[model samples]
Target chain A: MKEIYLDNNATTKVDEAVFEEMRPYFCELYGNPSSMHFFGGQVQGKVSEARNRVAALLGASPEEIIFTACGTESDNAAIRSALEVFPERRHVITSRVEHPAVLTQCRNLTQKGYRVTEIGVDGAGRLDMEEYRKAIDDDTAIVSFMWANNETGVIFPVEEAAAIAKTKGALFHSDAVQAIGKIPINMDGSAIDMLSLSGHKLHAPKGIGVLYLRRGTPFRPFLVGGHQERSRRAGTENAAAIIALGKACELAGQHMEAENTIVKAQRDRLQDALMVAIPNARINGGGAERLPNTTSIAFEFVEGEAILLLLSELGICASSGSACTSGSLEPSHVLRAMGVPFTCAHGSIRFSLSRFTTDTEIDTVIREMPAIIARLRQMSPFGREFLKGQA
Target chain B: MWDYTPIVKDHFLNPRNVGDIPDADAVGEVGSLACGDALKLYLKLDDNKDKILDAKFQTFGCASAIASSSALTEMVKGKTMDEALAISNQDIADFLGGLPEEKMHCSVMGQEALEVAIFKYRGMDIPEHDSEHDHGHAYPDHEGTIVCKCFGITDTFLKKVIETNRLTTAEQVTHFTKAGGACGGCIPKIQELIAQVLGDADVQPRTRPEKLSNMKKMQLIQEVLERDVRPLLWADGGDLELIDIDGSRVQVAFRKACAGCASSGNTARMVEVKLRDLVAEDIVVEEVSA
Candidate 1:
């Protein structure tokens, strides 16, 4: 069977160009950039070049970018540093749809006496901007929100939300892990104080991420071992990952337009095909403006895990909300927070596309999806119940 | 990534009986996609009513689950109802060169489904009781609130399954109850009740297989740790580390997701029980709280 991979939000295959660009760093240029030796200084120059490349991708200055292990590390460092630098301000605001990296850290902070305001989102996965504005009091230290949701692909108005935080004298952070490559984001124009990006999401190798800190932003280092990242983040630099990220960002800039237009069209075609092929299927967060290359659909009365497994059998890779939490019966909190009906939440699947997703792959899925869904529906007691309920 | 047995792999790769049979003598459906597994089995009786002339199934589940369901139809294609019902979960497991016990439920699911089909053929409901007569305490009062949601076995049923199966401990009861196993939600409740029932009664224990020993115990634990548990932990963004082993007290530490889970204590207890069940019964597992 021809394999079709559509779960881009989980991660993407490393671009061959990016990998090739990183190969020299692993062997020939292997040197500690922090060392004063000429060999190290040469590696430092390459690091600087990579930094500039990343900065150019985000429309940021090279000095403002701090490298971390991954997006989660960036999220933690940014969120924790904002609160730690200003001890007097105990209130932090963020949305309910943040990745666990932000949500769990904020939860820990809440337990330690910092007040966390988890602003709810509308049914389409859009934030209640009015509610966001009201949550930002004078004591609010920071507001962290994602530029795009990983599950639903709904784009949030971070600039507008950041403006509210700015008026309140609070710093703002946006986890643009899902948006950095697919969307055009000029850090200088947006009022966001900080942003986090991951390499893997944009077809770079995993284990490297960037935190864009606005100059003069009060921050504290999460890891305090070495002077790397200018003492902002400690630990020896991941030279290969950094180089790959730089190359990946350059590729992103090159492919951004095609990614949005072609990839989006293919995603839409796939979604339309599935909708026509399958019964009782509804796109999740369909009401909001979403990332062009992502579609979340709930196949009513069928659990997500079973569908993903079935797709996997046919060499089609996709992700599902309930599948991700297979052992536990709990539905996705993001879906639940939106008050998605229990009957729908368990059946949700997210098909995230990338620049690499081909028309042929989408067609293959379109061809096979109807048979798979029908076969599954025949076996599903819940589908039977749902049909009865409909009757 | 899901390593299925060859039979299971064969079934998944080329599922037999993928569609429904028209005008089938009886139909039996077990599970649903919402349950993360589902199977619809169709049976056609032989002319003499002694054997199944043909069988077909539609299944939705993991590779092993679907394979098991498909394999089930293939197994009972020309077999008599008694022969089909006589087929054990062990038979299915053995047919598939043994399944992971966590996935043993799939085999159980297949057996229950076949039984249901047979019952449907006989114009009877899936039997409320496995056997006609009360064997020890297999049939318990159904009036109480269900405690084990995974298997739907009530507290009364738990006691009955224990006594009838000659299950001296919590793990043995799982064969009948399948409780306190999946999700490990009702473990503490089951453990509490097991202790109440056993209470160090120490009625001369049944002779265990010589293969069930300390050496076998370590080997099995090592295998489970290396095989099933480790990969599952990695998938959850976590890992498990062995802390210490002092006669019956196996201590372990959670490395990542298991480490940070609010339910770490519960996970620790579950790990202990899983280890014990896979290895030897005398073992008691605990988390080393640092």
Candidate 2:
């Protein structure tokens, strides 16, 4: 069976170019970037070049970029460093639809004594700017929000939010893990103080991320150890993955146009086919501005896990925001925060496309999905009633 | 992904009886859309009305849930109503080569559906028993004292699972019964139940406190804060001053460094729960603006 990989928002397959660029770092250039020896010093030069490439992709300076393990670490480093820099600030502001990295961390902060104000989102998954504006006060140390939601693919007004946070004298951060490769971002003109990006979300191998900290921002290191990342992040560098990330960022910069055009067209084709073929199927965040390469469709009355399992049997890989898929008793927090009806929320499936996704793969999914949903709906009690009503 | 057994995967992929039985002798439904899984069981009885001629199920859930329902319908087929009613959740799980610990509720739902089906067949009200059948005694139903607010697991239900599973630890209880799986506010109660079931003679039975008036509750909260909480806060260069008490809501202000401390919410919750434990078991403490 030919595999059709569509779950790119979860993680993408490493680009061949990135893999090739990283190969030498693993074998021939296997020198610690921190060592003072000639071989190691030569490797350190490549690491710096990699940082410059990554910085160039984000329109940030090399000095502003700090490489971490992954997006979660970058998010943690940004939020924790901000709080540490301002010990007197008692409050933090964030959106209710943040990834677990930010949401769970913010919730954990409340237990430690920090006041947290979670701004709500509208039915289409757009943030309530008025509530967000009110939430940021003198006590707030940082305002952390996502650039694009992973599940819904809803793009937030991060630049505007950051500008608002600036007036309140709070550090602003955006977890742009999902938005980095799919959309254009220029940090040179944006008010966002810190931004996070994961390598794997683009085409790089996992375990590599970049935290873009605006130069001259009040600084505190989350990890205090080695003289690495200019002492901003402490640890021996993941040289090979870092090199891979640099190549991936360069590829992302080149492919950004294709991502918004060709890949987005394929996503729309699949979305249109699924919506037309399946009954009561609606896009989760269709009303809001979303990433071009992603679509979250909710097939009401039929469960997502069952649909996903059936899709898996056909060699098609996708993801769901359903409770069962997440191993949680509740559906995705993003869906819940947007007030998605329980009928639809439990059946939401997220199909994210990458540069590798082909038109044939999208066609295969469109051809097979309706039959899968029909089979499951026939067995579903609520779905049977819905079908009967339709009849 | 869950390590689902091949049998479970097979059953879910190809459910045995997937449809509602029209003109069925009895029908039973359990769970709701909000709960994320639900099952409706239909039984077609023989002329004698005691033997189940056929069984069908319609389920809305994950793989384990669907497999459990499918396995249930297959298990109950051709069995008498009494025998069908005797089949436990363990039997459903065993048939499917065992379900994941967290997905045990799916099997439990199957058993509940069977019990309800039997009740419907006999035209009897479904007994408010702990669903898990082992001791064979139907304990008095007390839905008021809900221990695990996350799953709505009552005190009686907690004791029943503890007694049936012979569970000694709170972790095991959470595994078999998802009582403290969410929010975990009821974990202490679950631990107390485990101790009680394990025959720890030192542990006394918890008695329900009588509802206090607003004035009396406020007075107790202030007294407790001054006597117990204030000393701990003062020791940490922090002070807790009670501002107002509106019913169960106890509003207090943190002074000094404690106000800006990251762990203040935990401190506030600790104070709230402590006052609730001492005063009324429903006290909510909030950090009020000074």
Candidate 3:
């Protein structure tokens, strides 16, 4: 069966070009960058070039980039460092819909007696700016929020939220794992003190991530070992993945416009067709500014797992906010935090596109989706009653 | 991803009986739209009303829920109502190889719908001991005090599921009934209910004799201590040695982590209770340095 994978927000296929660029370093150039020999020193230059390429995409200095294991590590390091630096500050703040990488860490901080405030989201999944501004105080250690939600594709105003944190002297961090490749970021004069982006989210291989730390932020090391990444982050450099990530970042910069145009068109086409063909359905984060490559549609009276499994039978892969899909027994925290109605919360399906997503893939999804919803709705008691009443 | 069994996949892809019986004899419904999954079952019975002629279901749930419902309909076709009610949740799960532990509630839901359909159709008042959520529905669902308000599951419903499945831990109860699967305000209550169920089973092994001579009582107390109490302490890197027994007063010395521990007083109480439950109601356990 020809697979039509629409779950890019979860992870993406490694780009062929990016994979080829890092091929030579596996055995031929596999020397440790920390070694004194010329073989190792030569590999160091390529690593620095990778750093510069990643820095160029974000409009920041190469030295500001800290290579970690993955996006979760960067998030953990940034928030933990802020708390350690401002140990006297008894407060921290984050949004309710952040990826578990940031949200879990902030929640654990509360156990250590830190007052963690999770600001709420509106019906459209936009952050409550009033709640955020009021939550931050001079005693706050950090404010960690995401640049975009992985589930709903709803973009947050992190820069503006960071500006509010600045007045209170709290370090601001953004988990840009979902937003990095799709959005054009200029971190040069931004109030964001720290930012996190993962490699697998882009075309680079998994297990590689970048933490953009402002040059002069009070910091501590999450990993304390060899003097790697300026001793800010330790462990033997992941040479091949770092090189691949650099190449992927450059490619992301070049294709940024296409991401906003071609990918957005495909996303819009898929969403429009599904909405038109399927009745009693509405888009999540519809009224908010969202990433161009993503759309979460909630079809009422049908559960998401059934739709996803049926989609999987056709080799069309998608994701869901239903409790059965996730290991938990409730809908996704993102949909719940947005106050989505109970009727639709368990039926939301998210389809995210990428630069590699073609129009045919989009068409295949749009063509197969309505009947899938109709079939599951036919099996649903609520769907049969409401649909009958409508007829 | 859930490692769904091939049978579960087959049933979900092409569900066995996927429609409603228009003039069905029994209509049983459970779960609401607010909850993630809901099932409305329609049953067609033979003229005598003793056997199920055909069964169909309309389920709003995941693959497991659909597969479970599909399996239930197939299992009940041509069976007597009593035989259908004998079908436990584990039997439904066993029909599909097995479900993921987290998806066990899907099987429980299937069994509940079957019971509700038959019991309501028979016009019999359902037996229930918990009376918290007794709104007296179209069918007599004496659900009894609602324990998990998020799922609208009652303690009576949960206790039946818990006992039928032989579930031991609070986590197992959540997977089997979704009692503590949300907000988790009732986890402590679920734990209490589990203990209550487990406590009922705990008293079955040894019955306290109605009449016993003093010599027989002393021997039974020592036997209960050696058989039941010592192994439990030994598992926790602690042990207790029986020092002496005189009539109702039995003495023991704590060893290892139990020795000189602040909570040893509580440990002595535990030993006393074990002896009292098995040996004699008036039995008292005393700690002595040996």
Candidate 4:
């Protein structure tokens, strides 16, 4: 059965070009980049070339990028370094809708007597700039906000939020895991002191990530031992995945236009038709500036996990912010922080597209979504009541 | 991702009796939209009004929930009211080859709706339940001090679920009733309730008794075994009978499912640990033949 995978925000399929690019590095070009030998030197050059490719995608210099194991590590390394560099500061600020990688870390800091201020979001999942601005103080070590939420795809104005943190002499970081490939980013002349991104989110294989630390930002190593990543990160290089990420980054730069145009059109088409065909359905972050290839639709009086299971039966894969799917007794923290009503929050399904997403896939989802919602709604007590009123 | 049984998937994909009976003789609605699942069960009685002629449901929840509801309707179609009222949540899950532990509450919801339908049909006075929060605990028409504030679960409701499902751990309580699944502020309370249901009358639950004579320790160990340990094992279709008590070592013989069980060593160790925790610090449990 052909799988109609629409859960790109969770992780993307590894691009074939990227897979081929890293295939030879495993057994063929298998040499330690740090070893002082001719074979090692050849591998070292290729590693540097990969770094250059990754840097080119972010409009950054090669030296600014520190490779890590995954996006979570990059986020941890960036935040921990900021706090270590400014040990006197005892406050960390992050938005409430950040992925658990950053949110959990920030929350843990509170146990060590560091004050954490989680900036709230509006019902549309837009960050509250005023709360964020007021939260920044001279004691603030860093302000970390997500560039685009993984669940809702709502984009935050990190540049503006970063500028506010700088006024208080605090470092600013952005977890751009969802934004890097789907949208354009330029580190040059930007106020963001650090940014973290994941490889697998952009068609690269997992287990490779980058933390772009601007030049002149005070740095402390999160992992320390080997001189790998210029001693900023420790251990041996993930040469194969690192090389794959480099090629993926290059392809992402090449596909940015199509991502913003064709993929965006597909996302729009899906959401527009869903809103039209399914009554009482609305997008989660419809009013906000969102990622080009994402839409979260909440069908009232139905549960998201039920919709997803029905969708799954048809070879369609998606994700939900409902309480059941999250393994929690409540809906997603992102949805709750947005103050979304219980009616819609329980039924919210996120559909994220990619450059690889075909129009037929979107068409398939659009054609099947209304019926799925109708089926579930028909079985819902609230839905039956609504139908009775309609009758 | 739920590791659902094939039966569960089949029922979820092609749910049975997915509608309401317009002129039904009995109707029971449990759960709420805020709880992330709700079910309205309808039952049509035979002309004598004793046997269930038809059963239907309208459910809003995940796959397990819909499947559980569907299974409940199918299971009750031919049963009399007395037979239907005796149906347990575990029975619904059993009909579907069992549900994931985390989703046991879905089966519980199905069972609650059946009881509510029968109770309302008998004209039992069930107060209107608050649906603003996560759980509709009052659906069973029982009230008590709220225990799990996050899920809006009450002590009476939780204790009944704990007793009926034979829930051993606080985690199991959460899985079966969603009582302490959020914030976890009420886990200690849930544990206390579980101990209470298990007949653990010791003042300090799970604390080793202090200053007991060697003979007194033996009696206390037996009491703890009879009170707490045996019931927990029996809940799992297993049993152990006390064979002998030597100063610090206690001997027991397995019965039923506990007999010839490969993991009975772990079970014996669990009994030893429970005894040590509740009776005396040096208590030991050894399994022996009858």
Candidate 5:
């Protein structure tokens, strides 16, 4: 069976060009960029070049882009530093649909006696901008909003929300992990004081990320040991992964348009075919403007684990909300916030196409899915009743 | 990926007798939406009422849940109705190799479904044992919280099994009480019970070299049978004799049930697994062929 990968939202295959660019850094140019020696100075030179490459992609100055471990670390640093910058300002504003990286940090702060305002999202997983505006006040130290949702692919209006936070004299941090490569982003024009991006999500190796800290922003370092990352984040830099991420950003610039056009078309085609094949299936976060390459559908009656297992057997890779939260039995917090019904919640499957995804692969999934759904439904009491009602 | 046992992997990769039977003699269904697992079983009975002609199922749950149902269908099909009902949930799990701790509930569901299906066919009322309803079995001297809610095998149960069976340690009581096996959250309680039981024993200090063998499993089963089931049978003026064993199954002879009660089907069926697991693995025990 031809292996088909449709779970790009979870992670993408590393681009060959990016990997090749990173190879020399791993063995040959392996030196501490912090040291004053010639070998270390040469290492520092390559690090600066990687920083410039990432900065150019985000339309920011090289000095504004600080390398971190991953998007989660960047998010944590941004949120934690923002609060630390203004200790007396005890309030933080964020949407409930934000990734756990942001939501969890905010929750930890709340436990430490900081007031947190978790703004609710609309039924489509879009943030309630009015609620966000109401939540941000003079005492609110920071407003952390995600540029796009990881699970639902719903894009939030971060620019407008950042402007509101700016007016309130609060710092704005946008977790741009999902949006950095797939969509065009420029920190120069946006009011977002800080933004985070992960490498693995953009066809680069994992364990490397970029934090775009707007120039002239007041900041506090999260990791305060080494002088690396200009004392903003203290750790030995993952030079190879950082170089790979730089190459990935350069590739992203060249492929963003084609990815939006071709991958979006294929995603739409798959959604259309699936809708015709399976009854009572609806796209999650369908009402909002979403990332072009992602689609999450909830299949009524069948749980996600069974669906993924069957798909794995057929050499088709996809993801599900239920399996991600298997032992806990909680539905995806994003989907739950969107008011997705429980009947479909357990069965939600996410199919995310990438720049590498092909039309034939999408068609194969469209063809194989109806039969798989039918097979599972035949064995399910809920599914049997659903099919009977459809008849 | 988890290192699933070969049986679990086989059942997961290719579950047996899936899909609904067009017509079935009886059906058993359990599990709920809130629990995130459910199963529906279909049984086709032979006209002679001696064997299950066919069995199929529809299971909606996790990998282990589906695999358990598949394993059960594989074990019961073509077997006599009495033989099918005698199959335990543990046998279903063991056949699937083994399931994870949390996933033991899947095997439990399969076993419960089989018993309910038999009850449905026999026109007997299926006992709806409410897990929430507390039994009046008071904790005589134990203070720890109860675990292994399935068998209600508490610390007290462990103490009793140990004291009554000449069980010198926790390991022997675990075989009978079934504590610290499923879930294993009750292991500390089992250890405490062992300490309490051993401290009270009046036996002299004699170093008895334990007989260690490769087939410790077989030895444990034999000991359980000798100490537990043998006395109960003797009291009823009946006896059980071991015949032979191929693998986990053991053939046994029931002196009274072989020719007595019309409901001998219940004895030949219900107690067969308990007898088999208790007997030696090579000693297949069955009621003498009528």
Candidate 6:
């Protein structure tokens, strides 16, 4: 069976070019960048070159980028550094719909006597600017928000939000893990103090991430170890992954147009076809300015896990924000924060496309999804309730 | 992923008796939409009205839930009402190889549905069975003291499962009963119950703190917030005010820059922990919208 992979927001297939670029670093170019030997010096130059390439993609200076384990670490380093640098500032701000990396970290800070303000989102998952404006004050050490929500693919106005935070004297951070390669980001004049990007989200192998810290930002290291990442982040570099990520960033820069156009068209085609074929289906965060290659559709009455399991039978991979899919009793926090009705929230499925997603794959999903939803709806009690109401 | 058994996966994929039986002799429903899993069981009885001729179920839940419901129907088919009622949640789990510990509630729902169906068939009042195990504490007005607020598992239910399963540790109880699987606020309570059940005569029953007037509690919380917490937040351009005092729950609203801070939960927990240390041990601080 041909697998139609659409869960790119969860993670993506490592691009072949990136894999090939990283192959030499694993064994042949295995010398540690930290070593003083000639072999190590040769490898060190490549790491710097990789950093420059990544910096180029983000329109940032090479000195501003610090590579880390993954997006979570980048977020952790950004928030922790800001809080530590300004110990007197006890307030942190973030959106209610951030990935757990930022959300959990902010929540954890409150335990340490820091006040955390979680700005709410509109029904369509757009952040309320007024709420955010009021949330920031001189006491806030950092304002961390996501560039694009993982579940809904809703793009936040991070540049504006970061500017607001900056005016309040708060260090602003954006977890752009989902947005980095898919969208254009020019940090040359942006007020964003820190931004996080993960390698795996953009077709690089996992375990590689970049934390973009604007030059001269008050900094404290999250990991204090042997001098690395200019002591901003400390560890022997993940040479192969760093190299892979650099190559991936270059590829992403090359493919950004295709991502917004062809891949986006595939996503829309699948989403529009599913919506037309399946009755009572609606898109989550459809009202918001969203990422081009993503759609989250809620098929009312039928549960998401059932839809996913049936889809799995057909080798079609997707994801859900439903409570059942997550072990927790509540649905996705993003959906709940947006006040998505429980009926629809339980049935939300997220389909995130990548450059690799083909029209045939989109067609396969569009063809098979309605039958899957129809089958699950037939079995669901809620589905029967809807039917009764219709009758 | 839940590491669901092959049997469970098979049952979830091709759930048996997946719809309602129209004109069924009895129907029973358990759980609710808010709880994240619910099952409605329909039994079509034979002419004698004792044998379950057909059993169908409609479920809204995860894979384990659907599998449990499907397993219940398969297990109860052709069984007398008495036999069907006797089948415990463990039977459903056993039939499906085994369910994950956290998902035991799904199987429990299956057993409750069967009992309710039997009661419906006999035209008898459904017995209240909140906990997974019922150790003859079948009171008409069953309102056991809620121990685990996360799952709403009661003390009586917790005691019943602990004793029946001969569970030695709180972890085992959590596995079988799910009383402490979430939030973990009840693990200490669960531990105390375990000690009490293990016949530890020296284990003293926890004393309820002397109840204070609402105004007095609010005043005390306010004083603590101002003296201990306010200065720390103020340094950072944030502050908190006591909102409401309801029983042990001290509702607080963040002020100044902290009002919309994302880590308010952690801050609230800090307040709760601090207040518990300084003022009262049972105080639970919660953040409310301003």
Query: TM-score for chain A of every candidate model?
Result: 0.97, 0.99, 0.99, 0.99, 0.97, 0.98
Docking class of 3: acceptable
Candidate 5: tens digits of C-alpha lDDT, residues B140-177: 11334465443344555356545654554444444433
Clashes of 5: 12
Candidate 1 chain A vs. true chain A: TM-score?
A: 0.97
> Compared with the true structure, what per-residue lDDT tens digits does model 6 show for residues A130-178?
9988778889989998999999999999999988988889899999999
State the local distance difference test value for candidate 4.
0.89
Residue B244, model 3: Cα distance from true site in angstroms = 49
Best by TM-score: 4
* Candidate 4 runs further than 4 Å off: B130-141, B200-290
By TM-score, the candidates rank as 4, 3, 2, 6, 5, 1
lDDT of 4 by residue, A168-193 (tens): 99999999999999999999999999
Residue pairs with backbone atoms closer than 3 Å in model 2 (clashes): A112-B262, A112-B263, A112-B264, A113-B262, A113-B263, A113-B264, A113-B265, A114-B262
Residue A277's lDDT in candidate 6 = 92
- What is the lDDT for A179 in model 1? 96
Check candidate 1 and list the clashing pairs.
Answer: B137-B160
lDDT string, candidate 1, B1-290, tens digits = 44456777777667777666788887776654334455677898878888888888766455666678878888888899899888765567657755654465567667767777777678774533321121111122255657777545578656644432234555645533456654567878877777756664447443323565566666667665654455455445566777766666777888756777888777767776666656667778777755
Which ten residues in a row are the worst by lDDT in model 1 chain A? A322-331
**lDDT tens digits by residue: candidate 3, B162-274:** 77666668898888887778789899999899899879878876688899998888788877876678656644657787899887888899986789988999999999888
Each model's lDDT comes to 0.77, 0.85, 0.88, 0.89, 0.76, 0.83
Those runs of model 6 whose alpha carbons end farther than 4 Å from true positions after fitting are: B127-290
Q: Mind giving the per-residue lDDT tens digits that candidate 3 earns over A1-391?
A: 9888889999999999999989989989999988999999989999999999999999999999999999999999999999999989999999999999999988998898889999999999999999998888899999999999999899999999999999999999999999998989999999999999999999999999999999898899899987999999989999999999999999999999999999998999999999899999999999999998999999998899999999999998889988888878889999999988888888999998899888888878888889999899899988998789989
Return model 1's CA RMSD, one decimal: 10.6
Indicate the TM-score of model 3.
Answer: 0.86
TM-score, predicted candidate 6 vs. hidden true structure: 0.81
Model 3: CA > 4 A from native: B125-143, B206-290
Q: Per-residue lDDT tens digits of candidate 1, residues A332-377?
A: 7688677666556767889999988888899889998877766666
Error in Å for residue B261 of model 6 = 53
Ranking by lDDT: 4, 3, 2, 6, 1, 5
Candidate 4: how many backbone clashes?
A: 0
Worst 10 residues of 3 chain A by lDDT: A358-367
Best lDDT among the predictions, by candidate number:
4
TM-score of chain B of each: 0.54, 0.59, 0.66, 0.70, 0.49, 0.58
- Tell me each candidate's TM-score: 0.74, 0.83, 0.86, 0.88, 0.75, 0.81
